[model samples]
Target: MKSEQGDPIPLWERSEPAVRPAPSPLSRDNIVRSAIALADSEGLSAVSLRKVASSLDAGAMRLYRYLSTKDELLDLMADAVYGEIVSEGPIVGEWRDTLRTIANRIRSACREHPWFIELLGGRPHMGPNALAMLEASFAALNDSPGFDTVDASMQAIRTVNAYVIGAVQAENSDLKNSMSKADWQKVWWPYLERLIATGNFPMLAKIIRDASHPSPDIIFDTGLETVLDGLGSQISR
Candidate 1:
């Protein structure tokens, strides 16, 4: 019943809080949705139970009646974003294609909510929506002969998830540092050229002289294709 912090287990793992009928207009879903909106616009640091309650025109005590802590609210926010990854209909295609679609969707989601990678870094999210995403991924590979056991399928899923998360984090960092291809060439190219002139790194000098700078999108697609290709080879073997 106790968490590592010596407090009671979080709200997500606990039974729902009791509410009097027709007592308040706020619901857990409303609170979570409002929190997600705040996060989407202002970033995750801006999200707090007080701010969420204020946005909903409710009291912080009202939110506590549902979600016990800000961590639980973050769990809910992460799961809500996962809910957006649902397919309108059944995913149709080979396992590779299905996985590719899912991976790209994850990357897009991360781009949309730059804070998602940070929220997801600490622990596994097993909320309903998060579980549903895992279920869908398992379903995609269920019929694949390469994944004969649950372990194989799960390994493949983890590999794809790891790649997607890392790729998005790198992309987000580049954006934060203003190091896009154009930005890099604009701001750092002069210093880079001088470094190249020193001839300390011949390969880097050659790259600077001959190679075009890659945009984040280009880097992401190239890395994704490489990962998918490696996964395909494993499945075939």
Candidate 2:
């Protein structure tokens, strides 16, 4: 098969080996699962072909038969997680509701696997599960009044995806450095108060004084609704 930029065709696009596996209990799924588990427990940096093989009680060379390089293995691992998003079934109800469901589900998955944000946009995700997600999303927008053409529909999907990725990244950042509300007041608020007291940034001071400190969940939902509102306007027009 032809290579792209000197790299072999992605694992998803490559044809499977013609020969069947010899008598062995190991499979590609097993290897991917083991790798995912390792990442979940010890972070993404901990995952290696040798470590995955060790978890499966198999030799590292056996894994090379399925995945030739660490990059290929990482692609497979990403696709495996995308499978979870696909299992949620197709989008339902109005276009807005469909997008909301998708965004929320992706957020949940990212939270569950903190390493997911690091892997986002790292490679093309053309595996079966990832393709299934794209197909389902396109189907949802196929009848939307605002999206009369394939390109328009895809653009709408892209808009929502961009928002979801950014929102999740922000939320994940807070989660990584999370502290209890009381703890934050004691430890960080003093420094923040000192900064606010300086007359240099009045608008920032007003916001801190006037705005309620909403939880991350509230912030995510509010931003998502605003995005849908903008999309709804186009649909209505």
Candidate 3:
């Protein structure tokens, strides 16, 4: 299959250089690992072949031998993070419990590597690690009694995955705001109080006055349970 670069073979499908100079430390794994580390520190936009090569103390062009394009590098980086998700041991339990484990692992990986969802753009991942992850989720759902058909199982998996992607994206977006919670309350709380005093937003005013601000983890867990509950109702039919 073609990569985004239009290569006849995707980077993951290509064999590593069979004739690299002896004792050379440059390999596809090293290049991708270096790239991931760079992205982890500097953000995804900061990663490039030149920077990755320099990080590895290798020539910039040397990286081309491993991956011909930046998109390919991105594929490797994303899959590496997927490998982290897989590293969490086998997911075992009832269908709901199994899905909860899978969803939580995915959320943790994205939180650790914030650039992961960004890399998910419009391209489908074909990497082995990504495939394995999908396989595990599908298998879990397919084994469940109510998910009797492949289409039913696939729909359930997609719903859970979409919830995770959207939820993590919201969390990451909130994190982008640099203001500390104390600063936010000290500065904006007064202004928000004035807005609430207007009595135009009764529900919002009530929330501001009464709702306990839950932690992100609590919000995520609550939302996941709701999603699973909805799915459970659908499947029980």
Candidate 4:
């Protein structure tokens, strides 16, 4: 297969016209999409070339037409999920607001897809869209009125990216399922209260006493606001 640069690296391994004697029958796009759907439904670990081929009603060897290996297909799938994110540029017209928009977009995309979380942690993105997304974000901060240099832009963008990724991690723990508020309290609170009542962990006890609920939404928004506030000073300076 050739890269976007037209450099021929390798081709399919199988033989025969029915298998991969000619060229790829499944386009890279089709392979990526199928992989994503399988991963989304059955989890990333459930994804295999054989599984995808079965889903497409094609021979297992047919996938070699497009992807050189399962690794290539996995990389393409990661990029495919990233491509779903739609950035708004900037809504509030401030550098911090622009950061927020980028953060929200990243969070929305990653958090919504369980497979993406696992994929990104290991794969280095070579996809055009993924590269474009990163470069575009850097440009937004660099071109903003307050942003002056690479250091400033990097710092601000890093903070925004960190919070977004943190939120995605938070979402993943709840990925399998979620419990209702009453159920959560009924199960977890009693244990927490018992620990707090013991006065063993002072900081823990203080926090538990002051906070009435374990709200993931509140944690995300509060962290988001604080991150924005910190970056605002750095950007404005």
Reference-based TM-score of each model:
0.85, 0.86, 0.91, 0.78
Model 2: lDDT equals 0.82
Which of 2 and 3 is the better model by lDDT? 3
* Tens digit of per-residue lDDT, candidate 2, span 105-221: 888888878777778755657788888888988898788667788997777788888898898888878877889989988998888888887888789888878999798889889
Clashes of each: 0, 0, 0, 1
User: Across residues 1-237, which tens digit of lDDT does each residue of candidate 4 receive?
Assistant: 556797875433323234343343555666678878898788889999999988777778877756668887777776676567634343345676777777777766766677777665454576766776778777777667767778877777767776677677767878566888799889999898888878788899777668776566677777889988877676556
Candidates 3 and 4 compared by lDDT, better number: 3
Worst ten in a row by lDDT for model 2: 15-24
Rank order by lDDT, top first? 3, 2, 1, 4
Off by over 4 Å in 4: 1-25, 86-92, 121-123, 185-190, 212-215
lDDT tens digits, residues 1-237, model 1? 567789877455776566555545777888988988898898899999999989977778888778777888889888888888764445547778877878888888888788888876579887888888888888888887687888988888888888888888888887777755686688988998888889798999888679986888888888888988998898777
User: Between prediction 1 and prediction 4, which has the larger lDDT?
Assistant: 1
TM-score of 1: 0.85
Local distance difference test values of all predictions, in order: 0.81, 0.82, 0.84, 0.71
In candidate 2, stretches whose alpha carbon ends up further than 4 angstroms from where it belongs are: 1-10, 13-24
Reference-based TM-score, model 3: 0.91
How much lDDT does candidate 1 score?
0.81
How many residue pairs in model 2 have overlapping backbones? 0
